[model samples]
Target: MDQKLPTIKEIAKRLNISVSTVSRALHNHPRIGLRTKMQVQKLAEELHYEPNTLAISFKQKKWFTIGVILPELNEQFFSQAISGIEDVATAQNYTVLIGQSHDSMERERMLVEAFRKHRVDGIVLSMAKNTDDYQHLEVLDKYNIPLVYFDRIPKGGQALSVSSNIRSGAEQAVRYLLEKGHKRIALLKGPDSLIASAQRQEGYTSALKQHGLQLDPDLIKEIDLSPEGTRAALTQLLALPQRPTAILCFNDYVCFDAIQAARQAKIRINKDISFVSFANLPICNFLDVPPLASVEQHPYRQGQLAAEMLLDIVEKRKTITDIKPVILDTELRIF
Candidate 1:
């Protein structure tokens, strides 16, 4: 009976050769004789030998697998970023296992533990919206797994991260609104727990200050990223005695809520109020009035860069002697 999936040791025993010799022959090592190489290969094929990656990894301590944790994949930003990550991972012969946190810290923590249990060589992560505390991430240190963050990263951390320059993007957006002669600019800011949101808020204020425009305390409202939250903020802003002439939304999708709010309040968009936000969605261009402008944070390239950094650390090709942020810029659209 054919031995089940012959091993290098088994083939060596059958051929009366050393296991090292059998291994070398199987790999076509330069030291192995061509005839001997052919013989070992033929026997391996006949025996239906298949190398065990998991067993091999036990020795090398590298699974050649990367765990990628995303907030969610429904948005084009995340989908594009994942595509970029896959591009680099596949080329490097590293398998990617994906986990979605659904913007929940608890789920993210569980996913981290699961990835650690699998002994992934490294991890690529984008934090959840409510992830203010990063204690859950410390678990990876115990397993010596390299980690890198893309987009939605934390304000404080030693790990490397790739992200769009949200501050600059928001500054640009605010400036664009100012140039159009809109002084009363309201910010539809995201939750303070999000670093991106904080940066965008910072940029909004910075631009207003730079242009000699006073920052209105009441004009800035925190968006919960929910329809109800958006509606409330919009209603409050519209009800103000001095309603903002331009609204800087947190994201493209939030613009939809802004538009809805304006319609119900009988406020004209672009004519009465303009909207500018981040990650210009595809539908942004197709909207009836479209956004005055939007920030194009290139999520795909952010993912690609994050993967490159993580792989470098995992391979020890480039050691991060000192911790530093790797910031990427938002892509520019024609209009």
Candidate 2:
């Protein structure tokens, strides 16, 4: 049978002192006499006593734990971002509770609810790709839990967020292809629900307009970022009457899928058609035929900044009354 653990009540009863006195002595409160403090410490050691962290946290109403929700943990970009968050959290003596939404709105909502019930001090989230609804996010506000979003933020800049300048990154990618003498450029974008997808589309259209090329509606396609969805989009683009000589993808993962599909269709990568993408993940370097270039979104930096912002709000070091979005500039990384 397991032994019953000692508590402050047991210590106070044995010492013939009040439970409050024992508690204060254990904490080394100034009101506690030196003799009483020593006695409490000695008894605690003798009894193998351990402080009740849950009780202390309840009394203080500060758990020193933060929750992080991401679309997918397996993605290289999100994995690197989580590393940054963990580094910051560990240094500050804070615990991070992680959850993967898997791009499902329902899963994201459930994770948010669970985090709230856990009484986490704050939350850092990368909204799921299909999460167009904001009720789950707004509930955090109702509970007075500060929130900071990274990467896949909501449509508006009304809330605190850390993200890359995706529009500029897309424009740079399209311009790079244009400079390479590829007039017909196609885009394999993410779901329309994602703000990042809209930004990429805007950039693609702007770049074409700048070069006096009309936007080809048929050349742009939206995919669910699934292997099958990406393959279907790639096939449709390839079947166009004037197929695109160059393609811009949502991210490195999408590029990987599209490139594989093209190769299966007997298309030579970088020779028959070049490809560019965002989220310049490290895995791209090891691929047999990697993207021609990628846009470096700096996922790690975004994670660090977002965590810092959320911690600041939680620790009362900064006010959350005003929204301050941190937008990092992206660079085109050539293979």
Best by lDDT: 2
RMSD to the hidden true structure, all candidates: 2.4, 2.8
Candidate 2 per-residue lDDT, tens place, 211-305, comes to 99988899899999999999999899888888989999999999999999999999999999999999999998888889999999999998899
For candidate 1, lDDT tens digit of each residue in 1-335? 95466688988888888989988888789999998899899999988898888888888788999999998788777999999999999999899999999989999999999999898989999999889888889767777887899888888745689888999998999988889899999999989999888899999999999999888999999987887899999999988999999999998778788888788888887899988888877777676777788899888898898988888888888876654668878753524
TM-scores for every candidate against the unseen true structure: 0.91, 0.89
Q: Which stretches of candidate 2 lie over 4 Å from their true place?
A: 1-49
Backbone clashes, each candidate:
0, 0
Worst lDDT window (10 residues) for model 1? Answer: 326-335
Residue 67 in candidate 2, Cα distance off native in Å:
1.5
